[model samples]
Target: MTPSPGRSYPILISVILVGLVALALGTQPIKPIMSNWPAALNIAAPDVLALPTAAPPAAISGAALITGVAQAQGEGETALEVYMAQSDVQEDVGEGQVRFTRRDVAGGALELLVLRLDEHTNIRVINADGATPGSDERGDTTWTDGQRHLRTVQEMTTAPYALRENSELLGAIAFGFHGEPRTANEGTVVIDGQVLRSNPGRATLCITHERRAEIGRFSSEDLARCAQAIGGGPVLLWDTLIANPDVATAEGEFLPFNPLGEDFVQLDWRKKIYNGRYPKTAAGIGLLESGESFLVLATSYDMTGIDLARQLRDMGCYAALGGDDDTSTQTVWRGQLTRARDVRPVPAAIGVYVRTQ
Candidate 1:
């Protein structure tokens, strides 16, 4: 406790060194530690923090699939192909017989049941005026009445019609600018060489005595040679694109050029009639580049006539003719019937049949 000055100073120095070591261990301050460390010591600072990357998205599966046209296998052999999202199935369809089922459209999202008939198929026209429910004096054909007519036809004949869709003529009661008969609705309608209705403008699908089906603007002279005819449309295509002069007065029978050039410009008639813009449903027949005939029932999303024509052309159609549309659009294949979402009673329909051997 009362030691000499030199000895006490030495002891005090040792105590101060120990206290500094304890403080260094407890605080661990970088500045203080660096000051005390040797200048030769080198250390890297901690790397900057980084976020981890995310995983990639998963792939989609079970997409829709479609098939090409089936070719005839051999002599007296015809093949039918059904396409769908799952797979393509082929069946041997016999002559004078029809095969039909719900299938996906090629390169499209819509599912439709298609009926295929042989080359010698017999088609018929069912006049809506002929089948009216609970009336003997030929009342107007309602949608319900049309269905009843289809049922009656199915029951009466063993060789039933394979497909049915609304024709181009408007009913007497259904008033509209689009459906209104372009010509007098009082003309003769012949179906499969049988006169169904003696009404003009009733010739939608014209079949010659040779059984060749022609669809377009037909004159009375043309009808005189036809064994069957039903009323339908403004021809969309005839060998080449049919120009609507009204679409653009300056174009003069040429479709007005769109900025993209791939699509058709909006027409004055479409804007005026369809209220600026809206989707349109239409039925049409086309002659393909491969000399094969195709029937198309299209539902466009806010498209004009030019747009429709462009699409048909892309689909390999050299010629196309539009038929009745809107709520009147319907397709019946085999026993299964499909009506438009907004159903309307049509005055007439075009029926496809297979002739018996």
Candidate 2:
């Protein structure tokens, strides 16, 4: 149908605007607009169940107490067996008959102990005349016989080769003769590879060039390199406790006369011939399993060789040798003085010095 152009244009424009508004409303949901409203409206609601969450683990305390049960159990299972094994090898006299009372002595580094020996105890002897004399000078003595006079000079000294006792006196006894001009004991005495005196003896104490002390009946050639020596006596204890009956030998290795023996028939004969008799006091040295050296003195009365050997064994000494005894038994321990009733002057003495830590 034919119409006016202005009127038709206005009618078409209004129709297009109405169609655009309807299309926008049809595409979007009414629920999206209701979601922004208050809960009271209750258009679309969230679920009732809550979401899961993770929590941290428990912590340890900084000041927690420790129970040593584990350590105690480990020790109980292992230590006792080891201790028992050691006790078997080492001499364990429940409580030794000789009570060793320890005290700190003066001058030397070694600790001193006063030993009181019972009837069952023993000791060793060390002679100083066999070694070089110390440098300290003592005094002189003179004897007037009718018209002729003999003068003798006495010196207070230590063992020259064994210098350990020079500055610090550890001598416990006076051994052997001093002024008599006689060939040194009948045995091989060597100092630093040089032979001082050579003869023959049943037993000898050999101090090696390295200062290790050994005791036995050694051949002259065997001890040619020794640094020092002490020659005397029947070896009371050798590798083991030597039975008195086993001491006799065809070669005279063991002296037939033992002053310590029960048979006192030869007491006067020994004193006159050997210049030795039963001692009222005695001294000796020993070596322990731990390699430590020990010095023992028996002052109350004389100790027999058998008794001394037994005592040394029970005291845990693997090897031991006798020293001088009688009134000549004078011990200068840590500078403290201990002497027997008859304190005689000695020309030389064996000294013990402890190494400083």
Candidate 3:
């Protein structure tokens, strides 16, 4: 459409006057709407696997990992350096009742799910067969010589294996995590107020009838406080600090089949087994703005027991103990696998549920 010259001149003059008025008013230019990332929400990147490093020394085999004992302890390798964000994704998934955070750490990520310990939520220890394994932990603390033998029990499974068998847990979990026992059962396990196995000084997860949770060494004084408990050692976090930074000190061997025919050999596989930013999990309790809360944490990639403790402290945890690491590290949040798929079948788990309010 062509404007007449007389009308165009008036329009130009009006535009000029508006421009001068805008300049005097200090009007700012509109920012461009970016079709791509420059819109600047600057959201944290998604989780990723750690970069490849030299192949770490492999444990002899899967069966070897399941049954081999450590003859001599090896020094832990210096961990790969990383920078975890002070805070990352903290979306409250189940209204304000449950929250999950996946904080970025270097190239990988760590996950934390905090469930409010309010009147609406409840927690319990779920064993695979609804019974604690009827096996006693018998073997040497260390085998100085290989020519000895002590028959022991082997009852290990994946997280999903334990999670699926319990019908009570299927539809009720707000969040759940694999309980301590990994290669072989260590520490203490108490189910339904009955002590299935009792050994003091292992990192223990204790839940009282009141829904209060505790993580620390299993001891006599602590026994009565726990209606349910699961033992995973080296206790990594306590009193809100990195408590046991040296959980890598291998405890002993797990050879149930007695392949070498010696009863057992002492081995510390923590440092070597959970190598270089491999995923790890833990159960803990922390004080938040709401009050003390239950915590189930995992690293998507790149963390050890010590690293996990540091992160938990940063996330407001007062105390915690290690869960199984590597593939044994698994979590379920509101019926979703926090990891991609269930690669392992565990024998036991801690399940949290919402009460029928």
Model 3 lDDT on a 0 to 1 scale: 0.45
TM-score of 3: 0.54
Residue-level lDDT of model 2, residues 65-142, one tens digit each, is 111000001121123223223332211222432222322112211112212222222222233333332211111111
Give the root-mean-square deviation of each candidate in angstroms. Answer: 33.0, 41.3, 26.4
Residue 105: error of model 3 in Å? 1.6
lDDT of each: 0.35, 0.34, 0.45
Q: How many residue pairs clash in each candidate?
A: 11, 9, 16
CA deviation > 4 Å runs, candidate 2: 1-172, 176-188, 242-300
Top candidate, metric lDDT: 3
Per-residue lDDT of model 3, residues 269-303, tens digit only: 55444344766667656544433445454445676
On TM-score, the candidate that comes out on top is: 3
lDDT, candidate 2, residue 20? 91
Off by over 4 Å in 1: 1-119, 129-188, 194-204, 242-283, 286-304
Candidate 1: RMSD to truth: 33.0
